[model samples]
Target: MNPTQKMSLQAIDLVGPSQPLVSLIINNYNYAAFLAEAIDSCLNQTYPRIEVIVVDDGSQDGSPQIIESYGAKIIPVLKANGGQASAMNSGFSVSAGEIVIFLDADDYLIPNAVETIVARWQPETAQLHYRLTVVNTEGEAVGFCPSPGVQLATGTVWPILLKRGRYHSNVTSGNAFSRSALDKVLPIPETDFRIAADGYLVGAVPFWGSVAAIEEPLGCYRQHSSNAWSNSQSTEDPQKLVKRLRWALKHDLHRYYWIQHQAKALGHPTQENLGLRDYMHLIDRLASLRLDPEQHPFASDASAGIARKGIGAVWQQDCLSTGRKLALLGWFAIAGFMPSLFATPTIEWFLLPTSRPQFIQKTIRGIKSLRVA
Candidate 1:
């Protein structure tokens, strides 16, 4: 390991393994088929001190029965369908763990996941992120999502999260947050972010304190047709796909703005706050490119101006590769000049085909297998 990485590990080791109570909050909303496995995973955890809380957001499916079957093993919180954020808020209200991990209903943890997290826990660390393996509906391991850069870094990751525009590095199921951190950022602000509730939490947590990361894949992220985000990929018609993308872009823009407002309210404005401004501006320029390209002759110029600013920020992120940065730059250029191109069905199909390319899929499987080995 490099000297920096060694030192970070040493620091974590110095904290020693103090296995405090951990709360695994499983949020469910009609994911009956996968609910049992998720609870079972928690029940089977290697960690000794854990309280499993299953929050059922008025699931019409048989999920309630399954959660009830867990009986005394897990605390069941049944509430009206107030979305993921509300369910998490409810769960957090009843939880009594020093560390909290929000595990999605469709995803489950590895037996040793909580154990690994506790091993690295320190008094000052606000958040900890680890890798997660992606699985299909049949529970087959597909691939892994690796945090783009500085996976072992144990400090502020706000800048890295902002420059990338999303928390692609850490999945909700694979993250653990200190109770102190949650006290600062949660009850989740009661926003319109249903699917990307984790995004809001992920964005705000780092400001409270340092974020440590583990390179190990400690949980499984199930990608299926029912997933709010993944369901858009199944759209076959080009116009429909474009509409979905537009809606998604708008949704993300709103979420970012909300986080920015939260940061300012909390009086912890960082470079990410400015980054969110540039991102929102970029989205507005792209919208202009799509809506009134003829009226705004300088739309492309405005888009390029914002794109360059974003590129500069992205270029400094160690989590992204050179090619990824260039790809983002190219995407910005396209969004500026030919916004409709992304909306086109042909391009959408090629980029997010129902079946991903075999070579790429094979490469991911190979990488995950190596990690497992």
Candidate 2:
């Protein structure tokens, strides 16, 4: 570790009872290979008043043995086979801290993660969303930030969510939830969120109050074979790409339904059509329609239909620059009007990150800070 990091860790190690009791929960399954590393990162946290919980959703592998070996160093829950949402529900049931962070078993945190998170937490904050650095199997940062550089304006942004259908957010490990807000939001719909439970949390929590943003990488999100979604076109086999788009469709609509549910419970207006106003989902719909029209879920959705709805969404997008809107509009017009053979690569180039040249990723990051001006 560098001197700067060492000194920072030393500073947080001395934190006292004045700090809120933060609970770091690691939800695991068949990730025995990465389980121990995840546990150590939490147990070794510099922030003093904290509890670490690991909920293993019945891994037939050696995961149980690893959890057993941890003994009292961590709280262990080895239950019958359930999905990600089930594991989170189990972890949240036993967690006793004011601030609860659900860390994926494959991800590890910086020593001061809890300290940094709690400092940003406010009385009305429903959840804290932070950025994460992508790491390889060898655990080195690959210079990628998963957050899409959109910040929901502070305070209740549910109106923004209803209008846009969703906000830019990160994966499971990059968020921390306020326990009180989660009490009203969680017990995540097990059937709907069987795999990506984070989607549910990110959408539902913002309804009760405000959401906070931390613009730094507090942890390392590891990409391995089991859940590896790549960005490179070379690795993008057509079958796999189609499968991913189908799943994205299901995942996007699932979150939208819950967002609608949250808005209605609070007596807020909701869109009449499912995800019709969502910008990113429209891109996915356009691609799916071109790639596999027969199996496409939206019967009435033609490329032009998606483009028209998406153009309106582009104008309604939060935290976007005019340059970005123009680029999106041009791409939509091209993809919507072009032949399938040409349109497929056109959309894939913009849709897949690895398909992007290194300079384009850098350009996206460079323009990440630009606003309406």
The reply for model 2, stretches above 4 Å from the true place, is 1-16, 147-153, 228-234, 321-327, 353-373
Clashing pairs in 1: 148-319, 149-319
Instruction: Specify the highest-lDDT model's number.
Output: 2
Segments in model 1 whose C-alpha atoms lie over 4 Å from true places: 1-18, 146-154, 159-168, 269-310, 333-351, 355-373
lDDT of 1 by residue, 1-373 (tens): 8999999998887665555999999999999999999999998999888999999999999998998888899999999998889999999999999999999999999999999999898888889989898899999987676534324445876654445454444767978999998998888855666666886787778767788888878999998988866566565554454455556555566657765665677675445434333433454445444544464334344655665665565555555555455554555555554546553322443335564457644643444333211
Please, what is the TM-score per model?
A: 0.78, 0.88
Local distance difference test values of all predictions, in order = 0.72, 0.82
Error of 1 at 193 (Å): 2.2
Q: What is the lDDT of candidate 1?
A: 0.72
What is the C-alpha lDDT profile of model 2 across 35-126, one tens digit per residue?
99999999988888899999999998899999999899889998997899999999999999999999999898988988899888898888
TM-score of 2: 0.88
